[model samples]
Target chain A: MIKVQQKDFNYSLEVAALSEGNHDVGGVCAFSGLVRDLVGDKHIDYMTLEHYPGMTEKCLAEIEAEAHHRWPLEKTLIIHRYGRLEPGDQIVLVAVSSVHREAAFDACRFLIDFLKTNAPFWKLECTGGDSKWVTAKDTDTQACDRWLNGDKKE
Target chain B: MKILYFSWVRDRIDLGNEEIVLPENVTTVEQLVNWLQSKGDGYASAFADLSMIRVAVNQEHVKLGHPIGENDEVAFFPPVTGG
Candidate 1:
């Protein structure tokens, strides 16, 4: 499942419901991303996110399909929020369930890494009465590229 | 053709989207950037550095040599910062 919304989400409830009633799924791996309080010493008051309407959803769906193709995942969930979000708010969540722990863990990390570099969302940082657009980091591109070269087991 | 700008490009260009006619001989994204620079000061400033910008043809991320056609949705923006 994939969802992009502006409302707050309950991580515990969402993960529980995703893994419920799946006997074959012996392991579940999940990751939740939260807004950090500091960025290069800037105190962030809030972040305003914008994304393309139809394109953003389509891009995420493709990423999810890629993960399932590479791993034997029983279930997967991705939730990303937009609009004005303050520090300590949840930004994104990824959960993967599989019969084995390795596939579950790998798929969960793959989803988040790809989302960082490939997603269409844009963030504006509001700090100390000033607002500016954040630039893409080279580290994010490197992280996504690591998956293209080989799997974690390699 | 529809042209969409995102992130810092949208902020600098002062608009998110617009419609324009593709100039002749502007087959690739690089050529299109040069054509756009001549439209106005804002367009020139937004596309100042060709290397720093990224392009997409019909919502798919593309390279500078990607082909663009009539009725296609073209987007230009800075590198993504989402995670």
Candidate 2:
């Protein structure tokens, strides 16, 4: 499943719901991304995230499909939020369940890595007296590319 | 045609979205950017760094060489910053 919305999500409850009553699933790996208070030396007061309405969901769905194709995952859930968010708030949640622990871990990592580099979302940071647009980091692209090149060798 | 701007493009351009009609010669994303840059000072500044700006044609992320047609929704923005 894939979802992009503006409301905050309950991560723990979401994990339980995704893993509940699945006997075939022997392992579940999950990740949650939170809003950091600082970016470099700048102190972020808040952040406003924006996304292309219909396109964002489409891109996320494609990512999920790719993960399933690569790993034998029994279930997956991706939840991303937009609009204004503050420090310590949950920004995204990714979970993968599989019969094996390695598959679950790898798929979970792959989902988050791809979402960071390829998702069509923009973030605007507000500092004390000014606000600025955050630039894309090169590290994110490298992280996502690792999966395409089969760096993990799984 | 709908033209959507995001992130710093919106800040520099001072608008998020607009309706526009491209000239017949503006057939590619590069050409569209060149034409838009000439519209006014704001557009010129917003599109000043063409290399840093990314384009999406019809909701799919595309490059400068991407072909654009009439009534197609095009989006311009800075590189994505999502995780």
Candidate 3:
């Protein structure tokens, strides 16, 4: 499942839902991304996330499907929030369930990595008096590429 | 055809989306981008650097050489920076 929303999500509820009704699953990995308070040396008061209305959902679904194809995950969930958010607010969540821990761990990491590059979302960081659009870091793109080359580094 | 812009591209272009009728010869994304650059100052500056921009046809990422059609929706934006 994949969700893109303006409202905040419940982490415990979502993790439990992923782990529920599955006795055979030995591990469920969940990763949550938070808005950082600083961009380099500047303190970010808040951030406004913007996304292409119809395209964002389609891109996220494609990422989720690719994760399932690459790993042995029994279930997967991705939830991302948009609109204005505080420094400590939750930005995204990726949870994966599998019979073993390796698949769950690897797939959960892969989902977040791909989401950073593949999803059509943009972030604007606001300071006290000014704001700027965040650009994609070279490192982030390289992280996503590593997976495509079959180089998994945990 | 519909064209959409996002992020800094939208801010620079000062417009989000618009509908246009093609000339029936614009076959690839590169040709359409070149045509848009000639429309006005906003588009010219917004698309000043082709390397810094990314294009998508029908909501999927595509290169400049990707083929486009009259009914397709094409979007232009900067590289993604969200998770």
Considering only chain B, report the TM-score of each candidate against the true chain B.
0.91, 0.94, 0.96
Candidate 3 predicts chain B with a TM-score of: 0.96
Better of 1 and 2 by TM-score: 1
TM, every model: 0.96, 0.95, 0.97
Worst 10-residue stretch by lDDT in candidate 2 chain A?
A145-154
Q: For candidate 2, lDDT tens digit of each residue in A1-154? A: 9878889998888888777998888989999999999888878999999888887888899999999999888999999999999999999999998999999999999999999887889888998878787888888889888888988748
Candidate topping TM-score: 3
**Candidate with the greatest DockQ versus the true structure:** 3
- Write model 3 residue lDDT over B1-83, tens digit each, in one string: 99999999999889999999986778999999989999999999999999999999999999999999999999999999888
Q: Report the backbone clash tally of model 3.
A: 0
Question: Which pairs clash inside model 3?
Answer: none
Arrange candidates by DockQ, highest first: which order?
Answer: 3, 1, 2
lDDT of 2 by residue, B1-83 (tens): 78999887888889999998789898999999999998888899999988789888888889899999888999998888876
Write one digit per residue (lDDT tens) for candidate 1, span B1-83.
89999888887789989998887788888788888888888888899888789888899999988888778899998887776
Worst 10 residues of 1 chain B by lDDT: B22-31
Deviation in Å, model 3, residue A93 alpha carbon: 0.3
Off by over 4 Å in 2: none
